[model samples]
Target: MTALRRLVATALLITAMAMGGTAVAWAHAVRVSADPAPDATLATAPTRITATFNERLQGDFAAMTVVGPDGNLWSDGTPQVQGATVSVGVRPLGPAGSYTVNYRVTSADGHVVSGSWAFTMTVAGSGSPGPSATASTPSADRALPVWPFIVGAVAVIALGVIWSRLRRT
Candidate 1:
């Protein structure tokens, strides 16, 4: 009976620890809201696109691009970051189709997050294409390597196994 109790307690401990680690991993910055919003259909083109995250962002590292339906870039100039919000100016939109907004930002915790969203304009504009939609690959310094976390999880499981064996002895 005592052995069964020990086993149950150990299982609970492992489960709790795993859940805690997952929560911490997901505590990084996440998009809370966006201007024009995801999948929104608008009658007029917005002059700017904005993304709001759950945490403050690093201004210098925050970047965004607006892509038109013909695979041309409509975003102009560098993106501006204000606290948890990042925005970039958009050219007068062209074509009445899907436009994609791609953004990358560094959270206060120093983790980089990147994502894309699309919105449709009901009417097209006569604006000229700016550039092509090309996202810069995340720099090595900004990349979050997973090897360390894998090593830590393995070490934890190994320690748990050793503890169980020692307890049995």
Candidate 2:
């Protein structure tokens, strides 16, 4: 019975240590900071956007969309990830106005975090955000079949082989 008690104590210590290690790993992710500082007022257009997190965010696949005062999308591409930070390029503004930066990301652990922030630019006009990329839209060609490309490639190769054989004969 004494030997069994010792074993149980050792197992509990090991379990606690394992949970502690996982907590440390997950500690890498909370949002530590952001540029445009959440609700900053700027005299001019910001050349870039940045978000800093406590944990290392999943790098390449994070998505970001900035809706300009005109309601147009200002993000040029998928946000780029570097270390714990993710950033994206911005579009030039024709007018100064309020803009909202809507951020969404999935952490390395697969948890999705989403939020929005607004900033004012004194430079003076507003435009509709260019397009709604965050929302899904219906497409006209949803019923298209995938086999046509495969069949066409085979047909073309067959035709080429026949022509070569005929020439040889």
lDDT of 2 by residue, 1-169 (tens): 9999999999999999998879645543577788878779888777688888877677644766777765567766678888778887776644677777776666767666666677888885333335754452222233347699899999999999999999999
Best prediction by TM-score: 1
TM-score for every candidate vs. truth?
0.67, 0.59
Q: State the RMSD for candidate 2.
A: 16.2
Worst 10 residues of 2 by lDDT: 134-143
Pairs that collide in candidate 1 are none
lDDT of 2 at 111: 63
The lDDT of each candidate is 0.86, 0.71
lDDT of 2 at 90: 72
After superposition, candidate 1 runs with Cα above 4 Å error: 1-25, 135-169
Residue 71 C-alpha lDDT in model 1: 85
Which portions of model 2 miss their true places by more than 4 Å? 1-28, 125-129, 132-169
* Candidate 1 structure quality by residue, lDDT tens digits, 35-111: 99999999998988999999888877677888888888899888999999999998888899999898888887677
Please give the distance, in angstroms, between residue 82's alpha carbon in candidate 1 and its true position after superposition: 0.5
